[model samples]
Target: MAEEPLLMNFSLGNDAILVQPKFKGGRWRERRGLRKATGPTGVNTDSILERHSKRQKTGNSDGPTRSIDYQRRTGLRHGVISSLFSYNPKIQSVTDRAEQESTTLPSNAPLVDGIDTFTSLGLSPIIASHLLTKLDIKAPTAIQKTTISRLLSGDTDALIQAETGSGKTLAYLLPIVQRIVQISEQKSKNGNDTNYQIHRDSGLFAIILAPTRELSKQISVVLDSLLGCARWIVSGTVIGGEKRKSEKARLRKGLNILVATPGRLVDHLEHTEVLDVSNVRWLVLDEGDRLMELGFEDDIKKILDKLEQKKGKSGAISDLPSKRTTILCSATMKTNVHKLGEISLKDAIHIQAEADAQQLLQEPTTSTDPIFSAPAQLQQSYIVAPAKQRLVTLYAILKRSFSHKGSVMKAMIFFTCADSVNFHYEVFARKVGQQNTSQLSDSTPELPTQCHSSVLSSVNNPDIMLYKLYGNLTQQMRTATLKAFSRNPNPSILLCTDVASRGLDLPSMDLVIEYDPAFSAEEHLHRIGRTARAGRDGRAIVFLLPGPEELYIPTLKHGFKDKRVNGSLSEDILRKAFAPAIASQTRETWEDNATGWQLEIERWLQSDSKIADLARKAYVSHVRAYSTHVVPERHIFNVKELHLGHLAKAFALRDQPSNMGRGGKGDEGKQDTGKHKGRNRDRSRNPAASDIDNARNSAPDPKEAARQMRKALNAMNPASEFNIA
Candidate 1:
């Protein structure tokens, strides 16, 4: 690997990275109007029996059971169904009408009603100072300016549009926090006469519903501190990845304001019988648009119906009225949002703002950014590259003149799916090897000679910093990765799905790569916006494959220039093959000729090493571990627009994951990297490549790979389970 071009810019190390959520103290409230079902329907009865039977079957089965994975996915499928049915028929009709209709709302100009201070937006004087001093929030962004008065005036049923990093989080949170504080002060003055039965389930207080577990935790982290000591007892978050029993145990006592995701909260609501949501007052649908996009309309509805039923009860819950407040905050709310507003809000006020907005009181810096923001500090551009050549193009970017302006920089490569990220990671690994060998053979000394090239990357894979982040990450692990990326000794790269695209604060990310851009153009904008934040200059690079003809438009393509789309290279098969295709290359291309080459090979054969480790730990492992990269919709013949057809034919086998890749195959991969040797593993290592070369017996078939991989896997027969993707 060539030494990276060094550039001097922002100081890398600083105070502990404080990534405050953009939604802190913003006026967005929880999505409410949910009620629990009093009795089981036929569907429920069937589901219970089905789940019980599944539990019994998996309970005794010991060989690589998928019970844990099924637990979450089962709930998810149920959430999808329940949420779909919970959308009262009226709302569904409205949704249908809106989808059929085409009405474009003209974009609004910057707000004239902007406030210069938090106090001007009704925050307490001390809180205002904290905003300016602690958070560096000098004034209100357009969302905050438009929402503050309305949310506080009790017209909480509203929807606002603004992208992430536009200070939108605080827009909904400030008012929520203020309202909570005021409620605390009021409750202190009032006695215990306020009944628990009248404890305001629906219209009582506030609940914020984010789409994913990370978003919930991110929001809850901010709220915990902002709410201060007085309301300590009133809040926390409820998410699926955490211990369900424990999270519910805390809520057993009840809470003033609850922060939750649509699915997990529904799970708790279904199971927790002692819960009361009658008096819930404030309802916020933060990122409600995303919920709809993720097919959570039904999940949201189930939650709302459960709350609504509890609130609408006649005799026992007489005090808690159906009348309540709701606030909807979305970066770009469309017809669905408007319809959702009609159902959730009671004659709500509309506060439409530019989806591409500016910082509070900041002078417009540049107006020509192809994306929006009168002066987007980020340099936004896209490149048209075939799926096969994106790895080369990204390498070009890392080697380009840009990003050299900054000493420490990060790139968040956005893929439509996690498997795509893995694909790119493999592709880059192959490309880097080809480049290193080419450079070394041509007398590029500073760049590692072909000898050290493979090892250089193996030791420090720039792509290793590249992680797969999506909605599936367990809550604890996701938070840890975010914290590490936020403030790290060395610059890092995060290969993410839509999970990190919106609302979350990923600081100092200087570049963004749209590896496989999303189906939605709005999504492309949000994905590219991770960098060049807070008045700092940033850059965006996009790679496109021509087969994506289904989602393209001429106008959108014009946003970029200097279009560079390189084709697939016939390179060494280090990793990056989409299909496990056969590719041949000379051994010397990466052969280490440093003194006794035979001895080195012999040593590699004798002891433990990371090179030997790659087969079980890298792309091969990912393909088995997660049945990803293939979206079921792509293969479904019904949807003409989404159907890959011919391309789908080429990957037909990838559609259904085999048992080996899915179960036993993945467990074996896990055991490979589960431990690290105390000594330099390579100094005494055996390359599996040699085993294949020496195998006169049908070139070391699956049995051999499985045998070699057994310790890396918990299962003896590793090929039994497989993942096609």
Candidate 2:
């Protein structure tokens, strides 16, 4: 019987060749004619086929046998070949890692056995009982234990510096509240003086100045909660974004404990006649470092001068402390913080919670420039990703974090500017199909009605909810957004700028993601401080680019006191993020889906002109904000070393960096029409018009001109009007 002819097909580059062998006279013979190649391009199929034909002619081996040998040697089998085309390194999914538990008390929690309870720290029994039963605060934090007694004395000004989330708020708050309550009780006991009885009409006795509006609101909330036991004393907040009329109404109604931002407080002091500062005794500057950084120095100086000039001018109202005790609270001690202390404090006692009370008292200046640390119970990690992979990597981190529906109930992602926050929030919302595409206004005054629905869903997680907050949003919107995110019990994510980075205590915040690094190490500390607060166990991770940004790791290690900061591979994160997709399809297919999804974002930018403009504005603002890093840390965050094109890709931008910020195709013809006509008229009038035009052209590139304009606008108002929603 004659053997059937055997045909073998081999692919070389973009071409393929067919070889047929025929059995004749009990021997196999090769067919010389080649079939058309149809494989990957760029490979030389002719030379490979020629070499195989020559080998066969020399009687070295049969064509099929040599091809089999070559296939085995080069791992060119179908499975192996397919794998080569879809090469992805395997890594352990983040889901497989064991959940970490808090082994140590929070840094703010009392480390020693002495003076653990609030009552032991000089708080009245009523206040202590209220704290324990109503607020569930069983004990005093280290800062509270050390500073409470001194602040309660009401004679010495104190500079309270402690790690973030270490109870600095209560360190000053409790003492002032305790004194007010005591004075009120004393007046009530004296039946002869009903006029001195503390009520809403009582003079404003305490002023708590916070750096951010959210923090001021938070402080007011905490004070209100504490005052549940003492209902007569009212606490109110005056922040920047709220209507001044309402704030004035509250001021006129009287607030025994007033919480305010410095700028707003100064404005009230200058404009409002009802704001009485003559009887003010307690001045608490919260987040002092941030207060100085936000250029509130002039406002704070003016406030101090006004307080001093009007202090006790109306005399004591109810036997409250006669002296005005200034308490300055900060996490880090910088030169500006010290200058702020000089402006607000007098004969100040330096107090820090990180050290022992005796040691701190003995060497008050030892921690003058101490490094700030996150909560001890916090698990801090970082991932170094390339610019192109940044967005997907972040998506993966969030996916892995919320993989288990109830495991991570809340997560916060911090960006550099409001524009970035707006851009990213919209991207994620649109990706999950939660965003309303029909909404034309990016600056929606209210969150979508769907956001209020408790049963929210996401593509990656079934119960995920998305919220965003930034400075550009209206004050009412910011307040409502924060309140909703805080109250939502389901798993949620908040995309925000540093507006949420100060002393605002978010509830059940299990994870904090620094999608963009802070300008300073101290600011980074504050960003991660959002989670793992008040002795609660939490996790934080930051994204760093692969170039000079990696150098920031050492700086972080130094700032965090060389804490165990672990590094995560972006590949691992990506793999884990796409695990759900991979489980449903082949690895290659799932990878393609992810790639296609990213491309879809690029396409979306191209199709939606409004979103495209927002994206460009966001990218420009991000690069500008990146360049404003603190001088000492500029080496690691140098903007000159950044790959603008790659970074633009992270924003789903396909345009060239040089062409960014310029008007789109539709606007190209319309731009500078009047100016061009003037130039043409000049050209027609004088021969030197060309030279003049040359000089004008040599002034600056469009990108540079746009950058200067943005800088000027930002200098005038730090929050960009273009950054909405």
Candidate 3:
């Protein structure tokens, strides 16, 4: 019998882990200076010491020390000591527990604690006072509870899981300020030590990575305000589809902290060599998982790789490291995400919130809930409509969502595709009175508006609040829209593509509507997360048509579920999709089918004047306005619906053995053990399977599960033999 192998932290001093010789026993000594060797089986103290220096104490001047400040109670004099990583309350995985009901409100519904309060969270009284009086914080959210402690205590990493709007921003923000304040105070205390330039003028200590331009701009603004008030340091932003010269100028000075999007940031890094990542003491990957899906995975890798390279040799981490902390915050985390978490964080501290906190979320509280508390905010609900009627439904949702919020409209509608994004902009502007002809005629001709405040939506009595943003927005328009969205008192509605889905840093969003449900289960989790952010009780409404129900499930990931969540909706969940004709008649609209039809016919007429001459201009307008990319671009005809057989042949994922973790020749994914067969049962529950399972006898698979009986029948019964189909 042997104990299971455990994952251990590597001593930063050297690559070779210190192992003691065992004299025919299982025990090994944990002492210093055992021996020195060379080659494949050798140890080098000087090299180890050099390597270890990267992760040395922030202010340590010595090569080695006997004890680590377990509580991190000593000198962090080299820089700001944020209380974020430390003093984090130890709680359970209560937040992502999931709903008990058969249906969910939104795919990313708060699974666990939507935390509130800091009464006993161990934050210093001075910082707590600042939070209460200066920042107006009442409580902590799930993310805040986990991350704040790690940041404050100066630990390696904090991998946090909770829903959006759980006060994750302040979870990191407050501690960053606190650490800076502490560091500044320390330098003041040691005024006489001007002999060395080791810890000279501060360079950028933090780099925050966001998935979207809007989110990056928003977070940058928030950070500016926090830092501005304290006069801590200067910061700048690098985002896509925006003014390049201006952003480049900002980067030229080299900010004390930088907030950026993956794509644009890559461009900035490529062009600006002196941006100084080597001085980056902290890195924040906001909406990190979304970066992977945005076709930015390569870019993110390139950036991190470059940054790692900047760390001088062995690895970027090998340069001036001191238990470097990596924080991964997201609405939902699945099993595959664990690898991503591992890649981002080092020696991570996994923190999960309780489910009840998420279910019980409403308003901020003053006690017990130290993480954060969102205000009982936006009005949330769903509308029943067919996929064909998606646009009409969107217009209806936007009109009502913003209209009800009053004259000032601040809303962002999400779409799944580029065409959908374009269509909505046109139709909603003209038909819905959100915008119209006059405005469109003058809309910069080539792109959207640049003078954001004056860029009124062209419609009947255009409201003070209205805008459109996506990947295609000209750099100027995108930048202006973001600036306006953040400052304008009037509520504005900005149509969004998947580009904005990952991070919730979009400012003052009281409402979010997913025009089209997410493509994958992961998408659904991140989509509705836009609202209810940073201690604000926001509302998120997901529009689910009937055809998609089978694909929908409650909490398909490690956390999240279709159980009872506070303020959850059950009305919009359309059951039993209608037959073709019935569904078309009831759910479809003129803009959808008519515009789509026109678009297809026109595509065929392209390059032929006679064919084009036959089609009416009105039809073309409708076609361009309503038809989706698949219809207008002829993509639908090109892409054939794939079946299981086709998938088995094309992807061939099924060729691999089921339920195995085998790796390569020597050390495959397999753990080299057969004891844990039932460790992970993948519950790939879908509608078709549910339908078939319902048709089944409610018994386990005969071949797999020895039991032939249904529910009440036990596996122990041998006489319960059943016939196969």
Candidate 4:
């Protein structure tokens, strides 16, 4: 049989060659011919040089002699082959083994040397010490462990997806700071021979973009803490609430790192000339999903365009490297986040940390199904009550939660609108103050105060303190509110709208109460993400209404279950919480029952009026906010219940009973005396029905008894009628 010619192809620089081997008798002959040669533009010179740089450096005399000998043997120029084949075969094999050992291990994969510390990831000794001693961060979190090495050792962009409070901030910040430190040390070693001209006022090396001002300020605070005692590393925050002149001054002072909101950063880039980020090596978009949800896409694109232009212009003028490594961190990987990554990042390493850490190098595809999973450590439950009783339920829950002595439980309560937040704060402040008043004088006793206003404005009582945060508040007021909640050293509650939900790094938050559910499941995730962070235990209680609102719990539960997560609220928890809250009656004042039938009629009227007032305030605020584009149109709603109902469906709450119209009145919830009397009459015929009726009627009728007592008191004193109104 004739020997089949074997054809093998190999690469030679930018060209490809095919070798045809022929066997004749007992010997073999080979013929080599160039198949194709690519043009210089088609050649990946950077990759070629990168591979060449990995070669082991040999003795200078032996290196050149070997390269010359190889060039002469191959009939190639010394210059061409010298750059490609600098290392000997033995050294090349060792380098290849080292490169293979450095690859990322899977989540379940064992470590290379079982060394899993900050120092092992190439962080500077000072930073590692600070993390261990000052910050008390002894070990890297799942996200940090997976990403730090990739971020610091190479030019790999990263998309980090860890649960909220899983140390994502530190994951990116540590490596970024380390890279900056390494570069700084190199520049210092080079002294006057440094290729880049870095100045005190133009030392911007990193930019972190947060979705909101609060988040931006939070990142700045965390960075400040981490960079503690690293005096050479200076970080600055540029948000909208701050003074432009002051921020410009800070920019002039030269910031090694900048944390900013997208719009404000874009404003500075357009208006300020002193600010320069041409050589920014790291661009981190924290809470990337929230940034896209807040409609910062254009602003983000604009900033990126400016950065690209700046890099291009600077590259033309200077020999300094201007490549940027982008880090996108989000709790959920939404489509918009993936789109943002594609637009901003190049060859990113995706590190997702839900159940495990999986490294993906290609573009990630976001699932069409909604993701609604809370942290595993978070204990989620809901209380079903009427909309009119929301405040009372909240008051009761707070009263129960903070009843412990010397307990320092900080809670963040989210409302649907600014009006709801303000109204609840005012009512809570007044009611708690009234309850705390001295009966002997009918006035508040002199007490230590932290707020400016004395009319229920300051609540420094040890039982509980009150603070409000909303978009309407001035920047100063918001700052004071956050500070009070953060540093008051007492049990406190922060009544806020969605403004607090995104990226505020509230520490030691014992609970998060959704006074009303978020406008969507996404917002709900961010809202509850405030707690159960960084491996800390926390709880969240959602106040759901009885009818359609009660359905939201199971819907949200199923969404998480679909993701194979244990985000379900235990039935026992819900049943227990809802039992007390549902059975509890609304507080009816003594004066509300002055006249026999007159008081009863007036009480109903007052209840309706209060509900109307709440609805009106919510509607007005919604219109104004959405009309002026203060908030997104989707966020516009008439009341908390309406908002809750709307959001529930977004989270996959299907088959929701539509019988309850905009009125949303639940079965006309009126207690009928004749109906109870009739049920008592049929007690013998239907024992089960009678038993249920008896249980329902067993709860004390505070309103009816108060009416009878007030009627008797009214007959004694006609002047009490004047006091009623």
Candidate 5:
């Protein structure tokens, strides 16, 4: 056999020394001869040996040169194999045990055999048939059953408190719609004239106020569907994002039901002359706690005052009640909610679903505080992950869920801010081989007409769809995005902020991942409430950082008042997250591939300036938002204890922590005053280059980003003081 040559390279200061090894008998031996070290072309090499001799004297030698080659070739493989197999074995064992022992609290209000159906609860036969045939609502939920009869009586104002997704919307809506229909029928019958019929000009009988435009639109949709059985009645929505002219036109035509957001409703009450409230009989504040949390107390107070001043002085309209009935619905009875009830409700009956039938019909009282709880059927859990592993762990969970053919078809991942949502959506969309739609023309035919412009599907896996929703999106886009997400039949994921947390009922939401914890425990309840809706079996998992964040587990448990809420350190989920790489033949290969995946993300961020800027903004905004946790929970989410570098890794950033400026506020102000003018000139001179310039200039100031975070936090906890500095 021919002799094999082995070469080894060593560095001494800036010089490179090459050595050859020879095998004598069966063992390897280093050659006695040494060639002079070479310096960077035409540099001196005499000092290399002197430095090596000094290292040998100091006993700081580089070990045997012959063994160096052998170790270099095999050391990495051994280390990686060992590490991969032993990754958090103790934690894995505990997680496995917990997984086996996991259990949920018995449903508080179990389904009763003799519960009243929609028809039995005083709904007309026509409405009941429409609900069953069109809406597929087979039965009234617990809250619906308890509150429908009370609302139908219209004897007093109502305060409906129930777990999220327990049919609070319908609890108030069904009664109002039924009353409107009943009044119209009675008027026609009493007058004994066909012209006595009620139409759109009959005046608005019900006003539904929601916190967000999306929720307002959703409420309008449900109201529209319920109105199908009585086409004579009309419904309309006036939210922040749509045209005021269109809303004015709708108001001019008259509507029996008006669903609106508080701000926009207040605007119309002050400006639009056609929006008459004199005949309004039913007022609903859906997601009442959320309305207060969003700082709508003033707007709501204005609305109530205006309605009272303009309320009809005449007697009952046909069979309808004389006084206006106000219904306030909320999942949590926080101090603000209680205060809101005091303001809007009068002689109100408090209704809640309870295990004890006797206690379910109690009147409103201020002495006893109500404990907020999630749905009993919801399977809630948490994962304690390091800051660096957050992104990968999320990826693992999504991958595992999507890998199954039909297990999880729809999922939601909630983030802290719009930037975070945008950042993650782009990262995952690009990873799945989809192009950035923002770079394309507005009229791109590649996107389906039914889908939003921001919605993207994986080229490799057509079944996987990604959607993004946040406050920054135009109202039309937000509405379109939500419509597409709710109707999508394939596996889809929505990355969103807290805007989607209240009163919006998304169908078949199998999973919810709280990538960022809510500002308060109540908010957390609302976030998880997105799943496990209407007695459906659903799952929710929240990610907590390894340190103080882990303490949040108990807080959540206490909030839910359920001992079954547990923290998991599941290796199986982590394995599944990295399954694409783990499918390889060897552990070493898979480990490398897994590591390479993260590196690939980091490289991608570096390649695109716009994406890199977004990642930094997301990281900073997340940290700022983390600081805005409610005062009681601040101990668990202490921002100073966070590892900025490690957190940056989750955003696929490779920069040092110190390099991440506080939102580039100083830099933004230092730019020339005519920078925008220069950009406009460039736009007219070269449109394509100006597009890139515009994108570069669009990165927001860090101070402004932090201010927005503080604003949102302030809205959630208006009493708390926030100092972002």
Candidate 6:
């Protein structure tokens, strides 16, 4: 067989040397008998005897050359595998045991005792201090500590699986920045007199692709902050929401680091020809599973193809530094992730972050199910309410949540659809919005007769500054809403759909409320992950009707069973809160009030009264608006049974689940049966005349019923009293 050409990387010692296949044009000459010393910046050739002399001083006394011919024969494509790791037979296992074992270690456990500090990981002075001082990042996270060494070596590819909010963003970013800094320092050492600078027209050195635009922008923001002192390392974002022209201009001006969504990046590749990733040394796919899922496959493939073609063309140039190192990160490993790895990555070292040691020994199998394990610091709970009373319950809960404590709370409220988001936003803004707006005449303002209008005149506790974020909003509006909510220090509630779920980082977020149950467990996990980030404590409450409470919630809990290897329990924080709240007369009052409101609402729908007609029309209009997102007249009460298994896995409950059999599905029928049995037993024992007398006495008076109905209505909406006119 013809010998492979040597593309040596000397940092791994004398036994290690990277091999590149012979080019078609034979531009790369083979030195069969020669030995040479090479650095990351460039290679320097030496005669055999001179190489021996240099090796002797370095204490790497001339060792036998280990053949890495497997790289050429193994059918590996664009991504390059390092020879240093190839020699280890155990690590060569496709289902890597060591990697899995490493993930099972306690999250706080140091990978290596001495190298726990940032500087110890070889980060430059500027970057290290920034992490410690500006970001207040004291030590590397579990994933970071385990993956940083291989990444900084510039030869290893990594597949990292860590929990959401485990600081995966910084894990990859730190190493990439360190490598760039290392290269610049090496350039200065190699007689380059120019200052460390990134050229606008020059090809990109790093590209990080994320699944969502929010994540893309977030990564860009983090990059900007990390490179705060290193101003010369230019970065930019290319995502769907922004203008194509602006992105093209930014690319035309050149960037050292590009954080982008796959689709938009491919658009520039196909249309503009402005981006040059030929020199990209690091490629990161954030949320790798989602990136390769249904919508993203083609665009991701095109981007990878473009990179491969660029690298292949550049391969003939012997002076090129190294092949791009690909890092694929996902919160949960789905079946397609493995396929994506095989297609896009080389022989990569896998790193899984887990809290259980037993999980490390088992081989990972790909599945459609999501892995569910939330941080222990996160407190999970739920509120059980009827469909009609949900809004009433929500208002009560919000009022209590805000008033119960003196501290300000930042909450992210999630719903199922955009229309739901819009309707809720309108209701809450009209009803619960603070009466702090410039008062009419700043004195005795004329109170509107309508209950909804009259409520604006009442000044009490600061009302929640409600903000809406959904798919229907324009890009500008969406960005503005997020910015305003994130920046505001006052108590605020951000009503959104899944658009806020995946990767947006909201600072100081104290709570997450799932106003609508998520479609799956994974969605729930990601939604809750919006809070309790980076070792901070946060609370998450999901609202479910009895039907969902029995069927879906338990299924959600079961989803976490396998993933929670450490044997932690999912303690429902709401048990205490629920007990106290249920004990209050307010609970009974609200239920009665809700029933009356529903009856009134229905009656108003058919009535000719002007006040009733206005409310009925408003309610119908809202429902119609919501229907555009899906089937018309579909009530939010109905929770679908789709993807239950997948959602169960993502739910990540640590508690023993309740029995979900006959009593679990629905209980209203069973209760009704018992009620009839009791009535029959009573009738059998009583005489006919006595039974009749008892029935007459038991029946409520029409006058009393009417009085109760009026009282309930007045309690629900104080403005209804004035609307009577």
User: How close is every model to the real structure, measured as TM-score?
Assistant: 0.55, 0.76, 0.54, 0.61, 0.77, 0.61
Q: Considering lDDT, which of the candidate structures 3 and 6 is the better prediction for this target?
A: 6
Candidate 1 segments whose C-alpha is farther than 4 A from its true place: 1-116, 187-204, 229-233, 312-322, 354-375, 386-388, 401-408, 423-466, 471-473, 532-536, 546-725
lDDT of each: 0.46, 0.67, 0.45, 0.55, 0.66, 0.54
Name every residue pair that clashes in candidate 2: 13-40, 14-39, 14-40, 14-41, 16-37, 16-38
What's the best-to-worst order under lDDT?
Answer: 2, 5, 4, 6, 1, 3
Off by over 4 Å in 3: 1-130, 192-201, 242-252, 263-271, 312-323, 354-382, 387-409, 431-465, 486-492, 505-510, 534-539, 544-725
TM-score of structure candidate 5: 0.77
RMSD of 1: 26.5
Count of backbone clashes, every candidate in sequence? 74, 6, 72, 1, 2, 10
Model 4 poorest 10 in a row by lDDT: 91-100
Q: What is candidate 6's TM-score against the reference?
A: 0.61
The reply for model 4, stretches above 4 Å from the true place, is 1-116, 192-199, 312-322, 358-373, 406-408, 431-461, 558-725
lDDT of 3 at 584: 31
Return whichever of 2 and 3 wins on TM-score.
Answer: 2
**lDDT (10s digit) by residue, model 2, range 1-725:** 99999887954753355333221110011112221222343222344434544643434434556455443432223111111112222332222133344465456554444223667778888888888788878777778888888877657999887888888887888888888888887887886676667988878888898877788789888888989998888888887767789989999988888898776788889999999998888888888887766556777889889998997777567476667888898888877788888888889998866454454455444444464456666777788777767777777676566666677888899987666776776677664345443353435556631242122354545757778777656676777788888887777889888878888899898889999899788888888888877778788888887667777776666445335577776766776665444343321323333444556566677678767766776786677667666666778888888777667768877544453434222222232233333232213223232233333234355344333433332232212211221
Backbone clashes counted, model 1: 74
Q: Which candidate number would show the highest lDDT if scored against the true structure?
A: 2
Candidate 2 TM-score, true structure as reference:
0.76
Best model per TM-score: 5
**Rank list by TM-score:** 5, 2, 6, 4, 1, 3
Model 3 per-residue lDDT tens digits across residues 339-449:
457667777775555433554365333322222111233234444333333433344344434434353345677765443454445434433334333245323534343
Residue-by-residue lDDT tens digits, candidate 5, 1-725: 99989766854764364333221111011111112222244322224323323532433333344133322332221121111222221232123225533255434332443323778889998888888788877778777888988877655898888877777877788888888788888888989986777799877888998877778888888888888998999999988767789889999999889998887888899999888898888889988887776557777889999988887743335455678888898877777788899999988998876542343334233423444457766778888776666776777677667766677888999997766886787777764335563453323323422222222333333567777777655565667778888888888888888888887899999899999988778888889989878777788898877666767776666435455675665344565455444333322323333455555566677688778766776776676567667666778888888877567778877544343333321223332234433322212233333333233223355344333432443333211111111
Clashes counted in candidate 5 amount to 2
Candidate 6 lDDT tens digits, 1-725: 99999987746655456663321110113133221333343323334324433432433323232112221221112122111111111211011111111122233223442323777767777887887678767777676766776677656788887766778888899888777766666655665665533444445788998876667878988999998867667899987767788888888888889998776787788888767777887889898766653235656788888888887454222223567788999777666688788877898988755442234446343355444345545656665443333554565556556764434468888876553554455445544235522121212223211112221122344545667676545456666677777876667778887778887889888888887766456667788888877767677777754442433444435323323211111112122223335433322222223323233333332342333223322232222222222111123323252222212211111111132211111122131234233222212222331233233234366344333433332232211111110
Cα lDDT for residue 469, candidate 1 = 59
